[model samples]
Target: MRATTEEDATARAAVVARGCSSPIRTATGVWVRCGSRIKSKCESCAELYRNDWAAIARSGVFDGPVTEFRFYLLTLTAPSFGRVHRVPRDGGQRVGACSCGVEHSATDAGLRGVPIDGDMYDYAGQVAWNRDAGLLWDRTRRRMRDRWDSLEYFIVREWQDRGVLHVHAIIRVARFEAPTPGVLRDAALSATAVSQVDAGVLVEWGEQARCDAFRADGDGAKTIWYLSKALNYVLKDVATASVDAPIDVWRHQVALGDAARRMRCARDCQPQDCMNLVHKRYGSRSQVVSASRRTRNRTGWSFTGLTRTVQRRLRREWWESRMRDEAGDDAPALSPPPLEDLAARSRRELIARGWSAP
Candidate 1:
């Protein structure tokens, strides 16, 4: 689909999927045929390609076994002196604390507690950097790894949704050569290493960046959604949105906080959290995993691209585009299905699963 327009993202997916199969050779022949004018893609070929993407977006794991390691949440704040809202809620009161050595909580009946100081870091710039954020984070990881005693592979990824970016990573501490937990999760390293790396890298990380450590735990469907691994996820996620918004409904902080704490706690609780322990840092290289049980499974790229932000944006863009097309074609406005439903599946599979409500 050229632009995921409303005219038919689902239908487009269905058509592409059903029409484009040709036993896609992972070999060079497939590329040559698909790209050449002499060759044409059948429905099965298209479906295979689209389904591959769907599978990756939905899989959420890397090509290899998941690594079980700890990660930290990061945030950088400007020096401002004022009462801050520790936990803001949606459809809830805006609570702020005073720096006068006293903490007070009152239900802001008028909802006037949250403040806009304008000193917050440049968020727009950070989001732009986040576009290539995966790379920036990679560089940061290298810097941090250098300080470690034992070398291991590390993978860092950025997940963005609704303008919020969360850093998910798989850090491998060398087998039988593990660093002490204090050293691995060292607060000093959290400060020094992060600062050193951040200094070399230029990212605004929206007003400020906060870093907290995460460890993975699971057995649940969204079990991969590590809360402890999200260390400090709630506040940072919410705060970043606040700085960029004209009006913030940061009322979900409580729920988010609970989730973040859980993710952090999970780091130590679950042993099978990551896809696999990383060894060597990535360097202009890529790996291929087959859909074999003993080897890499479906959790390739599919599960990742589906992170709430990317999925939401895909949906929103499609909806707006669809609306525009409707107006242009003089078609009456029809209530479109939620973009989320669309994001969760390729158009064909979605229709098959009966999640399609178009």
Candidate 2:
């Protein structure tokens, strides 16, 4: 009997590792996974989020007509705010001496992204660039489509260690219309947009950009894998500071946060009165990951009709079915209560538990 109990406990533990350990009780009194994409918050749900997007990304590459489309992986970086340390990753070969006139070893990780001169760093400009990155991308896509009419893309925005955003995009274009990687890179790098909020501000990609073309049948799968792995970086909060962070690193983050707090998110934004989350997120307001949408004229980024909404619905149905199987005749109704009712109940529950409602 003890052995049976131990086995049962082990099985439950395994199940929890794959699903939510602390499930939320909804208005219908049905338990649901707390769908957080941050791995630090919920490993199980984060894995699910990663997998769903990975599958969607793969579908865009493998599900459609293979030979008819050309695939390219493009990386765009933000303009430099200031000179920074160029410490290599652990076990990585040292590139060269840094601007500080010292050859930093790979072990010098603390100084990796810290500005060489913090006072001289353009923190305000960096945050403003983050705020306008989405608009810049919108302009970039429009420019690309103007030249190559059959372009569709999936883009992921990643935070550089210095607390700025850079973009990685998987681009697909009709085979006949696709340009050489160099031409594409030049065109994309040259494209610029003026900020709608700040009339005089010109938003542009950094000089360092890459566009590499790969055959959809050959290196395409590998490219998709590379991009999918970057999803891990998407949900991380740039403002989160490490407990063991070096003094310089900590100071850098503090400066960036301070700049973000005081910066206007919009032309009419009042820094004190504004409750915009961008102020707290290093001035970044755009979604971390997104793909072009299906339209009347263009095929969307995904070849399959797979989307986050569809994935969520499927997960809900699967969870309900599993519950029914486990509970047999005692299972609750599978249908969820109205969203408004659930939200209201959740708010009340939070308030009763000494937490403020949104």
Candidates in order: C-alpha RMSD to true structure: 17.8, 5.5
Highest TM-score model number: 2
- Where does the lowest 10-residue lDDT sum fall in candidate 1? 279-288
Task: Give the runs in model 1 whose Cα sits over 4 Å from its true position.
Answer: 1-13, 17-84, 88-115, 119-136, 147-166, 187-223, 227-358
TM-score per model over all chains = 0.33, 0.85
Residue-wise C-alpha lDDT for candidate 2, range 49-145, written one tens digit per residue:
7888888888788999978988899999999999999988876686799999989997788788899999999999999899999999998999899
Candidate 1 residue 308 Cα shift, in angstroms, is: 17
Worst 10 residues of 2 by lDDT: 335-344
